[model samples]
Target chain A: MKFDFNNNIPIYIQIVEQIKTDIVAGKFKPGERLPSVRDFANETKVNPNTMQKALVELEESGLVFTERTNGKFITHDTSLINFYKQKYAEELTLTYLKRMYDIGYSLGEISKQIEQLGGNK
Target chain B: MNTILELKNLNKSFGAKKVLENINLTIPRGKIVGLLGKNGTGKSTLIKLINDLLTPTSGEVLINGKSPSVESKKIIAYLPERTYLDKSMKVAQVIKYFAEFYDNFDSQKAYKLLEELGLDVNQKLAKMSKGMQEKVQLVLVMSRKADLYILDEPLGGVDPATREYILDTILSNFNEGASVIISTHLINDIERILDDVIFINDGKIILHSECDKLRTEQGGSVDEIFRRMFRC
Candidate 1:
């Protein structure tokens, strides 16, 4: 995984958002064992404490769970994953729309442009 | 103890000149803290005081609730701003010397790190570039299983790639429950790895804050904030 961090936001928050995006995009398989915090921190080139905080945030959201001696694993709840996927899509769409509007593009124009781009893809 | 290091009402002066004034700080375990300032801002002086290299005119420097002593030296591994190793010593000999000098030094880990960095053990310090020597020093320092590692300007004068390697070595090698204090003027390169930051200016601490909270509150990177605050 690659991280292009924006120092304007908290590092751990950025990691949490990136991991969430990865989970919803199927980059990390459901129920797959997560790497140890130290390994993950090394991979991300972040502090271990920041990585631990991100994992704790993920756990709080039910996307990750810890097994005492075994380690952390991604949730196997497909419904929850799908729900997050939809929510993420909505967020991206809203951001795109807001940017387009700021640049003087209308809702109709955005739909037409998106449809054209999607067709090409 | 929970607090790995503390300073209370610390003050230092040289003759008529005041180098540091009325400083107080506390550092908890398992943290990476950045001591940041412009050149000649007493950053080195503060670090020296912490390491007991210089005596404070007033106040106390405490490690694990005790004053700086042989006990504190045992738990704190220090990397000074200048290279202190013998230039005539080969890398392997240096490792052996460190192993004999510091009880907690791990020669195997040092060798592994040296191999990973592609540094030849037989190469003398004088044969290597300044950056390479600094890397060797960093590898040795990280190999020690110390509770608190105090690195002074570890990233200074190194290439970008070497800086990344230095940061990676620090991140990967520290023991659990240990804390690291890195002093540098280059904030952007090291800010991401810092849990907290201490900003000193004119012999006083101007700001001390958690990295994430500071970023969020100030709406900028630590480097940006430092530039803005210390603008000429």
Candidate 2:
């Protein structure tokens, strides 16, 4: 996972966001086991306590579940993953359009830019 | 969770020079606290008083509801800035020393950490570099199953990799219900791990709060707030 830590947001929030992004993006497959908090903390260069807090948040949100005897795993519900993926896509689209609107472009012009970029892709 | 450590109206003086004045704070179990300040602040002095290296001029410092004493010392594991272990002792002998001194010292855990860090048990402390010596000291200190662990500048003069290693060891090794008070000026590096933070300047507590609450209220990281507050 990519770690882009900055001073703008708290580190634990960043961890939660990144892990959620990976799950929603299908980089970490549903039902896959997550690294133990210690291993994840070392790999991400975060404090284990901070990682534990973020994992707790994820667990509360139903994105991850602990098996008591086993470690945490991504949620096995495909519908939940799809919902998050769609929510993320919608959020990104809104962010892009909002930036273009702030630059004085109308919705029509923003759509034209999007289609042009999409064609190039 | 119980309060593991508390200071009430604590003051320290060295013959008319006041180092700390009227400091009061409580540290609860299962928390990692950052004791922060600029140079020449009373951070180290307060730490020393809690660890019983020095006596307070007034008021009291308590560990587990008792004043600083042998009982308190048994429960509090301290790592001062300077190395106190004998330089001639081998790593293996130092482990034995810890085992002999503290009932909670786990020799197996100490040996496992030493092996993980690639330290030779037969290597003499005198032959190791300053940073390696510090790591050895930290390994021994953290090997104790103490209620309170007070570390003063544990990351000083270390490279980035070793810093990460030490921080990881610290986070993983401590026991449940244990409270860690780490005193350092390396705010950015340690801020994320802190559950709460205490800012001491001119021998007074300036700010103390849960770290996330402070972050949300101030809209800045602890390092930024510290820079703004101290202007250093």
Candidate 3:
């Protein structure tokens, strides 16, 4: 729950991104109940308002839902979760490729290097 | 009222010197606002005016749409820049004193916080270090069920680790819909918790903005913006 926040960016947006990563990575199980905004804010060491905004953003994206007095819960849709996972992987891959290209490495060379690293793993 | 506090054409002076000038601001409920500035930049003066500690030369200081009076004072918990507890009183005695003095003061919550901080209730104020005393003050202030909490430099004397604890205490405590106004020169440490920020310089408010919008527009942290704006 520790956040090494970048102050240059909006704190709530960072919270949304981190929580989204956690959800997609299975740290927060599908259909799991989330903590109250206050408890979440305390855990993340952020303002409750900021945490509320982040949760609302998550809800808007259909990753979370409110059940009236029962509080918030993660969506049980495995397909939605998988979709986000794929989307995030694509984003990371594109970023890596862009950086490699900027450093004068071709896509072929980058793939070879990644394969070598993966083989060692 | 929706607005917890407001200032209209606020001005203050001391003889020939103008300490605060033509200031106007409004604070809504359920917000944590940072009143930030360099030393002697009217931050304290603005806070003092809100607390009725000093009279503004003109304009008005409104708390819940009323002037600073006994009614407003009851709902506004104030932690001044300096410690004013009786030096001879033990921590427990001070809690008792505060309980008797302020109706909203929660002695049990105060004791719990003190225990968590590992501060002995029997310890006298003079026996504790300056940082420890400040922690005690913060615990007491946050223990109160006040509508608006005005903390002046609560993190000034504490170390970095203690600063985190202090910020946590502030974030966890406080009644819902209550606003907190924290004045500090240590911008980076407190900026994350602030919903809005008021930047003052040379007796005037240079900027007041939501922290996220300001970050997006200025392309930096509030600390960086402050440093750039106030650079000599």
- Candidate number achieving the greatest lDDT relative to the actual structure: 3
Each predicted model: what fraction of the native A–B Cα contacts (within 8 Å) does it retain? 0.81, 0.31, 0.83
TM-scores, all models, native as reference? 0.95, 0.86, 0.96
lDDT of 1 by residue, B17-119 (tens): 9999999999999999999999998999999999999999999999999999998998999999899999999999999999999999999999999999989
Mind giving the per-residue lDDT tens digits that candidate 2 earns over B132-218?
899899999999999999999999978888886788788778876798999999988877678889999999999998787788789
Regarding TM-score, does 1 or 2 come out ahead?
1
Model 1 clash pairs are none
lDDT of 2: 0.89
Candidate 1 chain B least-lDDT 10 residues: B156-165
Q: Write the per-residue lDDT of candidate 2 for residues A50-84, one digit (tens) a residue.
A: 78989999999799999998999999998998998
Model 3 misplacement above 4 A: A119-121
lDDT of 3 by residue, B95-130 (tens): 999999999999999999999998999999999999
Query: Per-prediction DockQ scores?
Result: 0.79, 0.42, 0.85
**Quick one: ranking by TM-score, best first?**
3, 1, 2
Query: What C-alpha lDDT do the candidate models reach, one value each?
Result: 0.93, 0.89, 0.94
Which stretches in model 1 have alpha-carbon errors above 4 Å? A106-109, A119-121
By DockQ thresholds, what CAPRI class is model 1?
medium
> What DockQ would you assign to candidate 3?
0.85
